[model samples]
Target: MQSTYTEGLNPEQKKAVLHHDGPLLILAGAGSGKTRVLTHRIAHLVEEKGVAPWQILAITFTNKAAKEMRDRLERMVGARVHDMWVSTFHASCVRMLRSHIEKLGMGYHSNFVIFDSADQQTVVKSCVKELRLSDANFPPRGVLSVISNAKNEMLTSDRFQSLNAADYRLSKIADIYTRYQRILVQSNALDFDDILMLTVQLFEKHPDVLTSYQDKFRYILVDEYQDTNNVQYLLVSQLAKRYRNICVVGDDDQSIYKFRGADIRNILDFEKDFKDAVVIKLEENYRSTQHILEAANQVIKNNRGRKGKTLFTQKTSENKVTLLAAGDEHEEARMVAEHILWLKSTTDYAFKDFTILYRTNAQSRVFEDVFLRQAVPYRIYGGLRFYERKEIKDIMAYLRLV
Candidate 1:
């Protein structure tokens, strides 16, 4: 008996979608239709499992992923999808804080402003200047990073101070963190890290609020569980403490946000955390060829900390994966440009069909230069080329002032 929502899902995906009770862990491999599983599970819960839409809380890593899940659920479950709580972790925190922030006795009203990175930097710079700290020794960005990391680890300014009392540099950073928090409070504002940190604080300090939410959202689903930091893990743990009906979807091999304080142990220790949890591995990839999956599996299997799963695909392609080596970034860019040109000249592919990816934005300069010199017209995706211009930034600053 296949429900409308669960139709066409693979056995592993169906197992993940149908298991509505208890803690579940879905080891979703790359291109393995994890999004489909997530969306279909929500739809199945609402459409077939007789679960109230409001009882489900589906959390993802990014706003875009959240929106995509919501849109997919809407197509399957009609307007009832609106009742389901589908949002990024930050968004969910913001929503909760809006209702219960003042309850924390933090002097912040529901209308507190959420400061962006720029605003946070401005405040950090002001704190540094007021404290008479040398800019070179205690850079604003460095100070902010410390504060952000502390928040990610669920450490308050005082707690961080106490923990790092022996370290002189951290002691100074603790002072900056304390003052920076005071200024944010005075301004009736919170930065991104504060959003998560305060929500955890709100839940911890106010048990009634936590209980209400815990009772309301009976089923909790978190995407990208591998990328959750300590604070995020605590937040989810608190909310799902009562129901214990939590489902986390992540590939430990794909955990790549360590620099952003993502703790891989959250996903790795899922079984230990929920001893009775059901684990399903979604290893059937639909996007890549068999050869590519084999190559990726070989590389990823070397990671000792991961929950082991090998990805397999039905797609058959004889093309072998090519390994390219270059002396430096310049040579790499040139090699890429030359290869792309060669492909365009030999094959029927157009320039629009070929896409180049790099590790960071800084690495794009070499590629952009090479492409320009080679007369290869290219567009940078996700780069703020226009808004990041000096004149454009100046105009924006002036507008904000006016």
Candidate 2:
């Protein structure tokens, strides 16, 4: 509704901006103005369409994106944007559950905790010892993945036993899952899956609370819809029933998380779920060149069962996505080192501006040694993030108690 705001945007982006309606799906390609459209739509709704800022739910994939979107929308519509329900799916679900966790016998300020994959692995290792499962037979890592998969599919221990009792291995995995869940519940903690699963349970069981939120948040927007698993999809389904102003934006080609229980079925069944839905394809490439676009198109063309869109690019040339093979890791390191030296000396590339990724953490040791030899300053962003670990905090607390 902000006429002047749409004046600067191109026709496609303008259409997206004006489309402030029911169950919109914006299929954004890489480097497309998806963020721009998202921001403008939010701004337009708040600024001109008289949609109260609190009623709009703008979700993103990452906390960083959520922050950026909130900041950008705040810039457009002033401090009122603070009232908007803008967060990642995990964050949003946690907040929703926090408000009503007591209904499930959790404390009001229960201080529910989350364990990272590594922490969960630690729990699994302890369980392996307790159960006396031989390392030769049951690897902790493999069992952990099995349990994670079961949780992702929203399978409770009883449900899994009833359904998958024929498989002995599956029974063992469910045994581990049941124990892991018990430890979590006993500790008054909730992991990422608990956030989604519990929210679904709360909504299904507590109709009054669901109705309150449904009436409170008039519009719900979900980003990265394809990544949603059973629990996440169920959460969306419950909310969408009442509000019906739900917009899900995602790319099927970008769905790379099948291993972790992300059901591409949610995207496939979008039309079936939402009877009256608007599907919009954003195919204009604003970042990549024609060559890159063509190569991507050719690769994705091999995939089956997709409502494909033709990606066209008016953009000019850029550096190519090089494909290379190395006989050994040493050869790979030497090639990488040479490239780094050339980039720093010949080209105007900074070490800070560049990133080098390897398949495994072990692979990074060679790169680190090579970079150190070349006197290239670099740091790997992994492992324990500050302020969260129990060992680190407990040490500090002991020192304080001393």
Q: What TM-score fits each model?
A: 0.94, 0.82
Q: Please state the error at residue 239 of candidate 2 in Å.
A: 0.8
lDDT of prediction 1 = 0.91
- Residues 285-394, model 2: lDDT tens digits: 88879889988998898989876877878877777767668888877887888888788998888888788876666677667667777787777777432333577688
Clash count for each candidate, listed in order shown: 0, 0
Model 2 residue runs over 4 Å out of place are 105-111, 116-119, 318-402
lDDT of 1 at 99: 93
What ranges in model 1 sit over 4 Å off?
Answer: 384-402
Q: How do the residues 1-402 of candidate 1 rate in per-residue lDDT, one tens digit apiece?
A: 577766788888888889979999999999999999998888888889899999999999999999999999888888998898999999999999999999989789999999998898898888888888888999888888899999998899999999999998999899999999999999999999999999998888989999999999999999999999999999999999999999999999999999989999999999999999999999999999999999999998888877989999999998888889999999998998999999999999999998888788777778877888899988888784544668878998999999
Which model scores highest in lDDT? Answer: 1
Weakest 10 consecutive residues of candidate 2 by summed lDDT: 383-392
